[model samples]
Target chain A: EAGVTQFPSHSVIEKGQTVTLRCDPISGHDNLYWYRRVMGKEIKFLLHFVKESKQDESGMPNNRFLAERTGGTYSTLKVQPAELEDSGVYFCASSQDPREKTSYNEQFFGPGTRLTVL
Target chain B: AQSVSQHNHHVILSEAASLELGCNYSYGGTVNLFWYVQYPGQHLQLLLKYFSGDPLVKGIKGFEAEFIKSKFSFNLRKPSVQWSDTAEYFCAVSWDYGGATNKLIFGTGTLLAVQP
Candidate 1:
């Protein structure tokens, strides 16, 4: 089975510009997650989606960032008027539905999209 | 706030040398720990995971980690390092808050360089 895949492995945009990152999870996976890693910092969780509905979004940093998983297969993270601080690597991961398995499921990660805001 | 910490930011080891990378977390409750590896130009992959039982877990490519509940630590180890082992390693932890949030808390990764 194919692992998680991300689009535009690298993106460069001017500050205040808009950018969208896309992620396609493995087939049949129902849980999709978004994470971000700033330079020299730990990777932080952004949001999660169980199917088309969002399970938790407490990690979302601000209002300018938005994520959606329409149809529950793939996910998109959009940043409007991007700021310099948003320049970093955005990672998308997915896992099997936890309800099906008794143990916690392992997440498979994508190559990650490196976003550069100048 | 709960957090993970990797004490070694970077490490250099000659081939065949023993390797050990320290990881620790600050949470008193039950946690599921994981160690992930990212090779150059590759996706992040699971090296091993600790959910419960058997604290010492072995993973692919001859890597292993020991989880010490008392120390709140999960350190990665290898008896002999190889050039192919060079990669970035990340330690993460997750816990069920009310109903298994499943959000991973990761530590700043440690970059390992195995000299051939």
Candidate 2:
């Protein structure tokens, strides 16, 4: 089984430009999540998808950020008019739904896309 | 309101030395704790996790973590460090959101440099 994979391991874009990061979770995994780590800051949760439905997006930083998971497969996070503060690493993770008897869900993470806004 | 903290921002140790990294979380409800390591040019990988049962959980690569509920801490430990152990370690806590999704809250990682 392949782990989570991300596209464009590194991205450099000018401020105000739009950038979209893609993530493909492991096969058969139903839960997908997005997280971001700004320089000198902790990694923060962005959003999560159980299948194609958005479960919780409270961690999203602002309105300019958007995430989508179509057909319950892969996910995409788009940042419009990116700001300097948006420069950091964006990580994607996925895990199988926990069984009724199991309380643990181990998440597998991707290599992460490093976005640099100048 | 929930947060994770890793007090050691960076650590330098010689090979074969004992290693310990402090991690603390502030959350009253039930939570799952994890220690993740990212080696050079690699993605985040699970070092160890604590869900329940024994507070001491052993993971791959001889890594272990002790979860202390009273201190709200899950600290990573290794009896002997190797040069290959140099990496950035992140401590994270998972909490249910709306009782549906379990999102991870991570701390600012600690960079461990093991000198050979």
Candidate 3:
């Protein structure tokens, strides 16, 4: 089973530019989550996807940030008009059946994409 | 609002020395706790988790954490540290919503530097 994989390990964009980060989760995993860690801050959840539908997006910071998972497969997070504060590491994670009665299912994380918005 | 706090922002210790990092959470309801580690140039990895049962939970790499409900704390501990243990450690918490889709709340993180 392959771990979560992200694209463009690093990205640099202007303050007003748009950047999209992609995440390919483990095969058969039903849950996908997006998180970002700003400089000197803790990692914060952005949203979650169960299959192709978003289960929770309350964590999304603002209207400029959007996330989507098509066909219940890979996921993409788009940030438009990126701000200098958006420069940080974006991490993607996935987990197996979350509805199970067992202790919280462990979430496997990917090598985060480091985004630098100048 | 739920939040996690790590007491130490950075720590330096010699190899083979005992290690202990403090973590506290503010959520009053049931919650799950976890400790994650991220090495240089690597992603965050689970070091240990505590959901229920025994408060003292042992995880990979000889790491362990004790969950004290009354104290609202989940502190990571290791009997002996190794140089390879140098990394950033994050403490996280998730509300126990009966296995619902609860998001994780992470702490500011502590950078551990183990000297050889």
TM-score of each: 0.97, 0.97, 0.97
Listed for every candidate in order, the interface RMSD values in angstroms are 1.4, 1.9, 1.5
Candidate 1 displacement at residue A117 in angstroms: 0.3
Off by over 4 Å in 3: none
- Candidate 2 reaches a DockQ of 0.72
Write down the C-alpha DockQ for each prediction.
0.75, 0.72, 0.76
lDDT of 1 by residue, A2-118 (tens): 789999899999999999999999999999999999999999999999999999999999999999999998999999989999999999999987554357799999999999999
Candidate number achieving the greatest DockQ relative to the actual structure:
3
Clashing pairs in 1: none
Can you tell me which runs of candidate 1 are displaced by over 4 Å? none
lDDT tens string, model 2, A11-107? Answer: 9999999999999999999999999999999999999999999988999999999999989999999999899999999999998885432768788
lDDT (Cα, 0-100) at A98 in candidate 3: 71
Question: What is the TM-score of model 2 when looking only at chain B?
Answer: 0.96
Put down candidate 3 lDDT per residue, A39-107, tens digits, no spaces: 999999999899999998989999999899989999999999899988999999999877776657888
Chain B TM, every candidate: 0.97, 0.96, 0.96
Cα-based RMSD of the predictions, in order? 1.0, 1.3, 1.0
Candidate 1's residue-wise lDDT over B1-116, tens digit each?
98999999999999999999999999768788999999999999999999889999999999999999999999999999999999999999987554645889999999999999
